[model samples]
Structures are given as structure tokens and as C-alpha cells.
Target: MSSAGPSPVRGGWLDPRKPFKDGVRPRKRQLGLALRDLCRLLHSDEPAETGRRPLKQAEAAKRLGCTADELSRYLNDTRIPSQDFLERLHKEAGTDAATSGQDVGITLEALLSLHTSALAERQGCEHCQEMSGRIDSLIQQVNAPCPQCAAHERRQEVRRRQLRRRQQRKLAIRLRSASKEQQTRLRLELAEVKVTVADLKAELAGKLATEAGLRERPAAAQPAGAQLPVPRRPGDRQLSARDVSAARQLVAQAEELDGSGREDLAFTLLQRSTAELLTPAETALVVVQLRCRERDRLADDLIHVYGRDQEKQDVMAVALELHEAGAPNDAGAVLRAALG
Candidate 1:
């Protein structure tokens, strides 16, 4: 404790002549400063008292065949020049001295070497090495698949298929149930149409009897060749029994098509029945009922499917039509339930 150890160096305790540890590289700022200093030395006039003037930055850029901005950026260490540009710069700086019969200077080579060394030092930096490692890890991660995520995706796909099958089965069952009910309803409606047709025939016969009685009373006052004009009954445009039977057959076929999921064909058949066979009231009732049933089925399917906004739109359209056709209460309730 009494004896003093070797006196500390003036700047710090570390020896001035000691070398750095292995794999050490100069920092970017230190390298940049060194490069800038070398640039100044190369670009300055050779002798202080000789009255020779160094080229201005613009003139120097002209000699090097580059823009003043580019040269300035290179000299300030803000940009790294290409190898060809550096070679041209070196040649341009030395060309004047060689032509004037003066010794070419070492400054140009020194600056180029400093710039190259600075680049090398930056490339070898610890931060750069760490960045390189991270880039490689990212590349490997991108190339290789994760087993857990892959398995999870596979399981999700399987579950999706299973759910779709379940929904389709449920839809098919509902379609069968609806078809049976439709058939029963159509039979009952056909019986009613038959009864109505019978009543219309009876009414038409009564009208003919009255017309005959009036014609008989006027017969005494009429000429021999003149014929009486027949009166038209209200039920003259009503569907006949044959037309009703045809409509019933078409309805059955349409329901079969609907059950088999050929709804487009079913609708086409229904339209034909409406246009050619069923009376106006019968057509309206049948079409409305079919449309309502189809809308209900669509709603059920939409509940379990993806991308069903269009189906919902179709449901709204049908509901609106039903409301316009005089079932406002039923249509309003359907719309409310659907919106809910």
C-alpha cells in the first residue's frame, strides 16, 4: 500500500501502444470522419505559398464528369461513390499535376483507400452482423412451415366440411317435410277449386234460365230471323275442372322438383301454371304460398352458410312483393324476424 504502482498514463490508465481486441472494426462515425479528412487533403492545393489554387467543387465535378451534388455528397461521406467514379476522381485529381510537370501527389490514393476501408469497416460492424443473422432467421422461417399451425388449419378444414354436410342434411329433411305439406295443401286447394267450379256452373245455368225467360217474353215482339244476345256471367273467366286438374298436376311436379333441389325448374313450371291454367285468384294464392315457402327455406340455409347477404336480399324482395300483394301482416312479421 505504501509503494505507488506505475503512474497512470496522462490520458487514461490504458497504455497508448496497446492493440485493440480481435474482430474489432472502426465505428461508422469514426470512419466517416477519416474519409472526410482524406477528401480535404486530396482536394486542396499542393503548396501553401505557390499561388496555385484548388479547383472549386463545381469545376472538380466537371473534371470527374459527375454532378456537383454527387461529388459533394461523396466528399462529405453522405454517399458512397461507385468504383468507376472513384477511379475517375483519382485520375482527375492527378491529371493536372502530371501535365504541369509536377510530382503527382499521394493524397488521391490515400482518399480512395480511406473510402474503401471505411466501407469495409462498416460491412464488418457488429450491428451489421446482427442484422444479417436476423435476416437469415427470417428467411428460414419463411421457407419452413410450422407443424402446429398446419395441423390446426387441416383440422379446421375438416370441421368446416363436416358442418356443411350437417347443414345440407338438415336442409334436405326440411325440404321433404315441406314437400309433403305442400302436396296436402294442394290437394285441399284442388278440392275447393272443384267445388267452386261446380257452384259457378250452377250459377251460369240459372242465369241462362233467366235469359231464356226474358227472350221468350220478347219473342212475340221480335222479327223471325233476329236472335237474342246472351248475357255473360261473372264466372265466365273462371278456370274449368280440366284446367284445375292440369294445374294440380303441375303443382305436384313443381313440388317434386323443389324437393330435388331444382328450384329454378320448379319456379318455371309454377309460372306456366299461373299463366296458362290457374285462375287469377288461384295463381296469386299458389304463387304467394310457394314464394313464402322458398323464402323460409332460403332463410334456414342462410343461417348456416357464408356469403348469404344476397340471399337475405332476395328474402327482402319476396317479403316486399307479398306485402304489396295484400298480406302486409305476414310480410311485416317475416321482415321483422329476419332483421332480428
Candidate 2:
């Protein structure tokens, strides 16, 4: 007690040598430094236990559900980490530091902003880079063209194409071993997917051309004998018995998928079912079946498609009647249905 031992290191975690010791900025390199510092601090602060050895890098990586090599890349700014990994790190560090009476001085908001900037910058698209790290104006003209928006749309189209190809391959494999009834359903689904692919390809090509300043001139006026396309409301178009039956079967499949916790596929099936004309009764049945978060958007689309007042009223009335009759035969089914 008489002789004073060397003073313990104070605030060593905030060493000036660290890259983000001053502050965390919304940049890839800065984020990497911050993450590195955070990992080091957390690892150092972990208490030693009896008969237990801790390898700092491995333990830290294990806590964040990633490998040591991945962590090293993240720390070196050689690779960008996903949003989920960043979130996990923030949560773990916050919880651990709080218990140890230490402040890591990092925030999730800063990390996410950095991530967004990093992604936009990584794309190397001029418009995307220009739009990065700026708050976009909320007021956009209805028909105004945005190069950045077009870039994002094109990226989405690419992703959709990849997904469509993957689904097509899966369907092709299933068709070989599927029963006749299953084959019929699979073929119908495949045909629908093909039509969608064609539309997507056409739209993507138009977007690419527009971006490349290759817009085509308007076509010459059509002949007088050519009939203009007639616009019809949702309920105005008639669906055959075969179409109606197929829609019902899709609805049943969607319900089964939903029960099995496959909500994404279920919602897609629901969208496919509603893409065509449905009678008020069938629409009501779909309303009773839809339980996903996208139900509101689907309902709005339905209202837009079934635009006439009479048709809208009929859709609502049928939905209500089904609710009253316990159509799905489940307790509180209506309460959980899209209409309710």
C-alpha cells in the first residue's frame, strides 16, 4: 500500500492510433476501422475464466456468426460486410460493453449509412454514385426520368432474371418426376413464368436503350381498319371454369405454404392467382385466404383493377358475407383474413 503500482491504463480503447478514434464517418474505410477497434476492445474486455483459453479473433468471429477470415477482410476494408452482420455486431458489442461499464462509441445508424454509401459507390454506376450519401427530393414528377432510379430498376431487373432462371430450372427438374396432375400445374406455372420473363426482358431492353440514348421514334399511324385496344375493368372480363378452378387450386397451395412458414412463395402464388380476372366470389375467397403483410398492397391493386363502383361494392359485400359465414372454417379466420 505504501508503494504505488503503475497506474492502470485509462481509456486505452480510445487510442489515438485507431482509425476512427475521432469519429465514425459514413465511408467504407472508416467503417472498417471502427469495426476493427470494436472487435479488439470487446475481445480485450472479455474476462478470463478458470481452465479456459480464449483466442480473441476466433471468439469474436464466433460471436458474430462469421469466420476469422471474413472478419479480417471486414477489418481491412477489403470486403464489405452485410447489413445483418453489422447489426449483429452492434447488438453484441452494446450488450457486452454495457455489462462491463465500457462505451464502445459506435452506433448502428452510422454503420447502416456507411453501408448504403458503400453499396452505391461499389456499383460504379455514375448515376448511383452521384445519388449516394444525399437525401433525395420527395417530390418527383409523375413522368420525370431519373437516371439513378433507372440504374436501380435495371439492377432489380437483373436480380429478377436470375431468380426466374433459378425457378425455371427447379420447375424443369420437378416436371420429370411429377405426376400428371402435378405436371399440368407445373406446366401452367412455367408458361406463366415464361410470359412474365418475356415482359421483363422487353421492359429491361427499353430501359437499357433509354439509358444509352437510343430511344426509337414513334411508329407510323395505324390503318383506319385497325381496332384500338379496348380497356376493361377487372370484373368486366370473364374467366372460364378452367381458369377459375386453377385460381382456387393456387389459393389452396398458397394457404398450405403459408402454414408451413413459406410466406414469400405463398404471397407470390397469391399474386399470380390475382393477375387474371376473378369473379367477385373468387376475389372474396382470395381475400379470405390472404394473411401475409403484402395483403394491403394486393387489396389496393384489386381496388384499382376492379375500379367500377358496382364491382367494388360486390367485391366487398361478398367478402363480408364470406366472413359472416365462417367460409374458411377456422376460429377467428375472418379476423385474420385480408378483408378483416
Candidate 3:
């Protein structure tokens, strides 16, 4: 006789009817089988009042406020239903048994105990299994307080606090790095501003000396333009001490107007002063002093007017100095435009 390839198996892999020691049936599978049987008995036949046939899986899920697919998963041991679903199922089973005049042979407490034990077993934690047993005992004894419940809640709260602290530490580290980058940028800007201010102060002093020298000249030897009225055309450099003083006062008033939120008026006044009262270098100095938003425009105009070979060389030197001083990108851009 031919030898049999292998003995035919009595059951498939994971047979629910097998004993626990056989290792073929797990607690979850057992729970799923029990729930499936309960639902089958509950939805077996319609009541006399309804005069309808048994409900389909979809209709049963609709009554339980769940989808057919979710019900299928719960019955197949592929997914665990929530505690609320278990409680609701137990109540429905009791109602069905009462209507049909038959016993469900399963209590709400017993169902819940099985569900908890199944979940604890799935986690493979001895502590969880112990807690599940303690909780189950308390349920059977009605109104009995559980000491371990408070301790479990406290441990969860401590873990949440530790996680929050770690997130805060990460955020603080990022902020500190950002603050360092900002400080470095501010320091570079401050140095550039200082260099520009020094250059402006020198130009203003030279203008002052020229005005003083004009005053020392004899009346007959003085330039004819000096005798002209205020508000002269551009390039008329014969400004008297009074005219210089008046121009300075006008700039001061413009600064006040700007500070008072009248920027349009201040800008108009500054344009008039630069066009008629002050020389190119003096205008540049005032623009720097006021820290005008239109400083780039005014600087560009000055660069074009200072068109002689020597003046162009001076512009180049100033641009190199500002670049070396680590001026901000905007300031450096203006200087580069002047060079071109």
C-alpha cells in the first residue's frame, strides 16, 4: 500500500473549539465567536408586532449605529469593539431574550469581563492582566472602590507631563538659536550705521567751514550770488550763515512732522530743502541724519551729480569702506549701484 503523505488534520489552523492549552484558540477569537453567536440568536427572527423577517447585517449595524464592515471585523476577531459597543450589545441581547421568552445565558458583567481579559491578554503585559482581574472583581462586588485605579491615572498623568516638558525643551532650543542669529544681524547693521554717520559729520563740518570763509570776505569782493534772495536755484553755493541756519531749522521741523505721523508733509519739505537750499553733499548728510526711507534715491542722485574723475574715485572708496564694514544688503546694494 502507498504511504500516506501526511495525516489529515482534525481542524484548521486556529480552531475556536480547541482547548486553551492547545494554543490554537486565543482569547480574542473566543470573544469574537461568543459575540457572533449572541448576535445570531438576537437577530434570528422578527417580533410578532413587526411582522417582518430577520434583519440583514447592514440593517443590524444601522440599529447599532455602526457600519456593516465594522460589525464584520468585530465578529471575525480582526478588530476589537469599544466598551460602549459591548455594553450596548449586552443590553440588546437581554431585550431579545425577554421578547422571545428565551434565556440569552450571558450576563452584562460576564461579557464585559471577557472583553477586558481579551484586551489585556493581547497586550501581553502581566501588569495589565493583574489590573484587569482587580477591575473585574470590583465589578462583581458592586460599589467597591479600586485603589489601583487612582494609581494608574497618576502614572498616565506623569507620563503626559514628561512628554510636554520634552517638547518645550526642543522649542526653547530653537528660539535660542534664532535669537543668536538676530543679534549677529543687528550688530552688523549698527556698525554700518556708525560708519555712515561718521562720513556725514565730516561732510557737514566742511560745509560749515566754506560758509565761514564766505562771511570773512569783504563786501565788495563777495560773490554777487551771496546778495541774492533765499530759495535760489540748484548749484548756487553762496549760502550765508542765516541761510544755513534757516535750512537746519527746516530739517528739524521736518523731523518733528515725520514723528507726528505727517510723513507726506515731511517728505515734501525735505525735497524742497535738498533741491534749493543745500548742496549735494550737505543733502546726503541730512538724509543720513534723518534716516530717510528715500535715502537710496537721494544717494543715487548725488552719485550722478559728482561726475568728475576725482569725485568718482571718492565714491568707489566710500563703497569699499561700507562693504568692508558689513553693511546690510540694502545699504550695500545702494553703494554698488553708485559704483556702476
Candidate 4:
């Protein structure tokens, strides 16, 4: 007893009977409850139909143009009927009542409304509660510092720095072992890559300035139903002659880098050139040209072959490859050439 164990914590938690502040009801529960009420009303015995036979499940299903199992599922709340089904059901119920000379006092519209209300009620209480819990967790996380997380992040940063240092060391060793000619070629490629990167930065700055200018312009009023012209991004603009020339020069430099076995640097330069120098359509055309060149190379591999059947098979395979590469028209042309 000795001080009653610090007067046992009382009434700290929320009361279960207390209503939620938002007053939002779970849709599924509401729909289920509504369906239960409807089922009861439909299945209830009528005093006016005392001498008449009750509607059997099979008969009801037949009238509704559904299987007996489907009707049973609907009555058991295992399945909800579609609007069309509900409408048909209402008509059938009315017809049965009329034939039996009983007033059921329910309309198709009323049944449809009940169904719609049930569906509308289907927003989940659990989902809202989960969202609220997540928000509270986020707020708590934002307000507090987690020591374990901080330590983990520190360890990760240390590991990353160590890995980067190791990579740099390995690259330095490789460069030291490379031939003089290879080193000179690599240095030149590096300079070219730097130049291309600088060009890309300048182009990006110019595009941003253009976008800012457009944004500052006053909005013009137009007639109703008239659409404004869609603004084009810098990348979408046609490549100028200067751009094409620069792209060609970059491509030539990249080829030299590649031939010198500095493919990584070559790829970097190519990417920069593509971004800063080529229009979308021009890039696509370049891709098609490269693909065609590759196809021709593969075709040349089979040129020395003597078998017509083998050549036809190889050509058909190439056509299929072209078709898969988004050049169905080119694929057809290849097939036609093979036939010729």
C-alpha cells in the first residue's frame, strides 16, 4: 500500500467512446451497414403477401438475369451490384409487387441513390488514421536529433571518402604506367572535354536568360477558345550551322580519344557535344546514320559467303534488328533489298 504505488496513472489516454474531431466515417463500414439494412428490408416477410409464395433465390436470379450464386452473393453482402443491376432489380421487384397487388413503396431512383451513398461512404478511416500517424512521426523526426542515425551517416561519409581516395590512387598509378604517346593523346582529349564542358555551360546560361526574358513579358489577351502557342525549350530549337560544325569537331576529337584507348573521356566529350550542339531531330538522324553504318558493316561480314540461303537468313536477322530499333520502314527496305 505504501503511498499506493505513486497513485497509478489515470485518464491519460484518449477515451474510446469519444468521437473523432474530423467526424469522417469509414466508407466500407457505412456501405456494409447500409447493405445490411437493405438486405433486411428485402428479405422481410410482408403481411399483404400472406397467401402468395415468397420469391425464391433462383427465381430472383432468373428475373435479374444473373446466376443464382451471384444473387446469393449480393444478398449476403459479399458482392455489390452495379447501377444497371440495381436498376433491373428495382424494376423486377416493382413488377412482382404489381402482379401480387402489394405496394413495396421503393423506386429505381431510390435504390440507385442508396447504392451511390454506400459507395461514397467507402473512404477508409484506417487510411486517414495511418496518414495522421505518419504526419506525427514526421513532425517528431523534424523536432528531434537521432544519435544512431547521425553515427550511421558519419560512418557512411568516412567510407565514401576512403573509396574516392582509393579510386584516385588507382587512376594515378594507371596514368603513370601509360605510354608517352597515350599520355599526350589523353591530355589533348582532356582539354577538348574541358572546352566542350565550358561550351555547354555557356549554352545553358544563354537558354536560362532567354527563359527569364520570356517570363518577364506581359501576358497578351486572346479570343476565347483560342490556344496560345506552346513555348519551346532550348533543347527543342533547331541546331545552327555553328552548332553543327562544333559537333563535328567534337566528334572528330572523340574519335581520336577513342582510338588512343581513352574511351571514357571520349564518351564524356560526346555527351557534352550532344547536349550543347545538336537539336532533337539532328540527334535522331545521327543515330539512324550510325545504325545504318553498323548494318552495312554486318552485311559486309556476309559478303564473302557463297550460300544464298545463309545470306538471306543473315539479311532477315538484320531487318528484324532494324525493326526492333524503331526503324520499321528501314527494316522493310532491308527486307525488300534482300528479296531483290
Candidate 5:
């Protein structure tokens, strides 16, 4: 005892109540969590007004006059509802001003503010840091793992490959078409050469016969190069370059208008483009499509807005008449199907 080594000091490592600085703080409370709590309270099996007879999601959506998907978003979305949505929801859910947490003395908005302040206080306190970290760790443990979208990416890759194949096939077709056109030109040139040779041979023979006849009788009054030229095909008329350029402009305008959601205006421009650029037959087909689409809209409007019950029948009669005429693949059939 007399020779005891100085005063025995016990100083190993001891865990303090406070945590170290620079640790991850607890996550802020999410609106989804708040909504989840409310939904649980509303749909609780025990001590709820509905009790054992719980309202199904579909039935609740039906009562609310919205889709079940929409109901899920309204009740479970992480984002706070807009003021307009809140008021509309208040009306739909029959949550009165008195019961919307003001009179009940418990409000989600107020609770959120209070919780934010409390969390801030804890985050600033060294003594509470350990508790915050523990709670965050536990919450993370309860979270579901993220799902991978690799299958979707694979599907997109397949679609892109299909598109590339289609484009390649189209390019091959165009090359084949050009080759066929070149072959056709070569064949036509060969035919022209043969015809020229035949003409030259005939001329030589005619000259020889003429010379022989002239030598014998001094009169052979007939030439063979006086044949009339054959006429070309009926629709072989070519368009001038100027006309094509004008038509292209109209088509560009039509596409622009279509992109802007002015389909009616787009139809007008397309009609103009066809009228200026296309043959009569091509124009007729375009007109058929436009008229058919318009006829459907007008027919429905006549019945609903104008109260003209016979308008559809009248339109059908006109279409049938056109079909009976040589226009059987006719605008009328298209119109009837569209309108009906």
C-alpha cells in the first residue's frame, strides 16, 4: 500500500451520450409519409366508423368520381397538393372547414411546420445526434430496393434495330429501283439502234429499186420514209420544275400546321398542295380522305348540336349514289364508314 504506483487512473475508451460531428442527419419528413399516415387512419380496420366493412379503392374512386389511379396519387403522392386541388379535394372528400384540422386542433400543415422545427433542433444538438442517426438507419432498413429498368432498355434496343432494318431495306429497294431504271434505259437505247438499222436497210433497198426502175422506166414515184409517228401514252405529260417547287412549299406549310395541332388548317394546306401538284386522280384520292374526315365530324355535330336526326341518312344517300356511279372505291364508302 505504501508503494502503490501513483494514484491508479482508469482511462480506457468510454462511449459518451453525444455523437460525433459530420454524421448523416435524419431525412426530412416527406409529404408521402404524411399522406400515408392519413390514409391509414381513414382506412383503419379497428375503431373506424366503417369498422370491418372497409371501403375498397375502386368503390372509393367511384364515390369520388375519379379513377383509382388518381385516388392513389391524391392520397399517396409525395408532392404537396396545389391550393386549387386542396379546395376541390375538400369538396369531393366532404371534409368540412370545421373538420379539416382547424376545429379538430390537429393539422397536417401545422404538424409539418412543427416537425421541421423539431428536426432542425435535433440536428443542431450533439446529444440528440445519436438518436437521429439511429432513426434514419432504421428508416433506411424499411425502404424497398430500387427496381432496375434493364428490360425496358432492351425493348427499346430491339425497336431501334427494327427501325434500322426497315430503313436499310428501303435504301436497298431504292438502289434496286435505280438499277432497274438504268436497265430499262439501256434496253430502250438498244431498241432504238435496231430500229435505226432497219430504217437504213429499207432506205438502201428503196434506193436500189428506184435506181433500177428509173433505169428501166424513168419513173418510180414512191418514198417509204413518209410513215406517221405513233402517239405517246395518255398520261405521259410532264410537270415543269416550277410547279413542283410551289407544291412542296404548300406541303411544308401543311406539316407545320399539323404539328401545331391545327388539323383543319393542315387539311386545307394539304388540299391546296394536292390541287397544285397532283394529277386529277391523285387529287381525287386526297379529297376523299379530307371529305370523309370532315363528313364524320359534321354528321356527329348535326345530330348532337343541330338536332338533325336525318342528316346522317342524307349524307349516306349521297355517298351511295356516288358509289353506284363509277367512283365505287369511292369517297362515299369512306365517308359512310367514318360518319357512321
Candidate 6:
């Protein structure tokens, strides 16, 4: 699922869990640098064009197979994304990780922390190599003439086979669902075309088999003057080129933050930047970033007004205090509810 848009931080605290899962530790400097870079995107916003929809957090969590809390934590800056998560983001969002400054050169082994020193390099944890080496030695012993691991491997293989079958079945179900949706859209388009042909036949006053009401016919089948698809009267503001350009630039800024070091800032900025125009969702982001996020005092004021929630106002106040005291996450969620 797509991130609600934008990066929150440049690089202060890389989610320790991400690199650990990848087997690498985040560099402190890299984390700090990144946070600083991404914080700038918090400053921009514009309106939206019709038909561009953003994925909600609940939907995103469901798609990612993560608990909403887990998704929120990752999103709300409690958890940093793993390499796998980043790959998923790139694949799903049509976002180029490199453009977002996610081109870290941590190797497959380093990325996975397969080597002891790799752990040391990322985490500054002393003697990770010794720990990795010990694990390796244990594996070696397990595979020796004593051999419990061989039996274990055979059992694991069987479980792996069962899991693969389960995955295939699920994939087939999803593919069928998607196919059905495509068919529905195609059918609608065809029906629309057929109505157009019938209307033309009717206009020529040739007897044609057809339904008799204006509302019953597809708008496209009506005479040229007929209205279609919620006819745009005046004041349907379309987004301009400058607005689109700002969004692109903001996206780049957010990415640089992800790479440079401030992920929290990147996440926040990403949210703000992605929705330049306001939706209920965008308004929510603005409300969160502008009124609530006191932690980023150095942060520009992006929100316009507060909707009436005493708890939200209180939360915002508390959050700002936390940020002033250097606790950003606490401040961020102070306003963003546990759900919604």
C-alpha cells in the first residue's frame, strides 16, 4: 500500500529493528543526516485532482499483513522500515527508492548482518562478529557426526512445502478476484458503448430495440449536449503544473531525508508532501503536523486550524512539550489517535 505520502525526518533515529531484520545496524550519522534532509518537505501543500485516491492506514496494514499498531508504529515513526518493507513500498507505490535517497550500499550479507563485523559497523555494538562466529560454530557442531540438524532440516523442508502450497492457493484466489474486477470494468465500458450505438439508431428515427427513459441510458449514448459523469459546473478546481512540480520536488526532498538520517521527519514530511491539497486525510495530516507536532518546533507551521477535540488539543500541547524536550514520537502520536 502507498504511504499516505511524504517523508517525516532526515535521519536521527533509524529504526533499529529494520537493519537488525536486514542484519545490518543503522549508522548514527546516517540516521541523523537523513532526518535533517526530510524535515523540509513539511512546508508544502496544494489541492488534489479528482480520482487520485490515497490508501488509508488500515487498508495499508491489511495489505502489508501487519497489525494496525505495527503499521502505525512504522508509519508514526515508532518503527523504521526494514529493507523488505522498503522494497515493498517501492514495488507498490511506484516510488524510486534511489530518488528518495534509499540507495544505501549495505551488502546482502551486511544488509542481512550475516557477518559479525557487519553488525559492528551498523550498530556500534561491540563484538558482533564474535556472536555471529559463535552461532556459526554452533551450526557446524550441529551438522557434525552427532547430527540432530539433519533430521530438523528434513522436517523444516516438509513444513516449507506445505507453506508454499498455502501461498499458491492464496495467490490463485487473489488473481481470480482481480480478474473479476477487470471483467466488471470491461463490461461497464461495453454496455456504455452499446447504449451509444442504440441512441444513434433512435435519433435517426429508425425503430430500435431500446429502453425508454433518459436516466436509463448511459450519458455517452445521449445526444452531444447531454451531461456525463457529474458534469463539471464552475469551480471544480484542477491541480496545476506548479502544484504537481511541488509534489515531485517534495517527494525528492522526503527521499533524501530517508537516506540522510531523520526518518521521523521524513515520515511526517512524506505525509504532508504527498497530500498538497486537502482531503479529510490530508486535513488530518495538516492538523497533526501543524497544530500537534511541537517536537519539530524548528519545523515550519503547516497546519491552518484545529478542529474541536479537547483531547487532540491536549495531545498536541503535550506533544510539543515532548519535542521541545526532544521526544518526537511521543509528540507525533499525541495527536494521531491509536486508530483513525
lDDT of 4 by residue, 43-99 (tens): 224587656454455655675688877765554333566888776665655565556
Candidate 6's TM-score: 0.20
TM value for model 4: 0.25
Name model 5 segments beyond 4 Å from true. 1-148, 155-159, 170-174, 189-201, 204-340
lDDT of 3 by residue, 47-159 (tens): 46465234467866777779988887776644778889988876776676567655666677777777877887877879876786686678677765567987898999999
Residues 1-340, candidate 5: write the lDDT tens digits.
Answer: 1121122212211111222234322332333333232332222234645533324567545654667776565444322334444334334333422233222223545445434534554457655555656766887866745445567778899999999999999999999997687556445533443454355446545755765655454233334544332222222223234323433444444445455665555554443333333433323333333334444332232223211222453334434434543455453444545455
- Candidate 4 ranges with C-alpha deviation above 4 Å: 1-178, 219-237, 240-243, 255-340
lDDT tens digits by residue: candidate 1, 187-216: 665455456445655765787798788787
Looking at model 5, which ten-residue stretch has the lowest summed lDDT?
9-18
In order of lDDT, best first, we have 3, 2, 1, 4, 6, 5
Task: Please give each candidate's TM-score.
Answer: 0.29, 0.30, 0.30, 0.25, 0.24, 0.20
User: How many backbone clashes can be found in candidate 4?
Assistant: 2
- Misplaced by over 4 Å in model 6 are 1-145, 206-340
In Å, residue 176's CA in model 4 sits off its true spot by 9.1
Model 2 residue runs over 4 Å out of place are 1-26, 44-55, 125-128, 131-340
Instruction: Locate the minimum summed-lDDT window of 10 residues in model 2.
Output: 1-10
Q: Give the per-residue lDDT digits (tens) of candidate 2, residues 1-340.
A: 0112112223333332544323223456656766754554453444455432223677778889999878867765447899899888878767666655567575679777767776766666567555643433332454578889999999999999999999999998887755465546545764664465455446545655664442233334545465444322334424335434554555666556556665555555555445443445555556554533334444443334433333345545544545554653321332233343
Instruction: Report the candidate with higher lDDT, 3 versus 6.
Output: 3
Worst 10 residues of 4 by lDDT: 1-10
Cα lDDT for residue 151, candidate 3: 86
Poorly placed runs, candidate 3 (over 4 Å)? 1-25, 44-53, 127-340
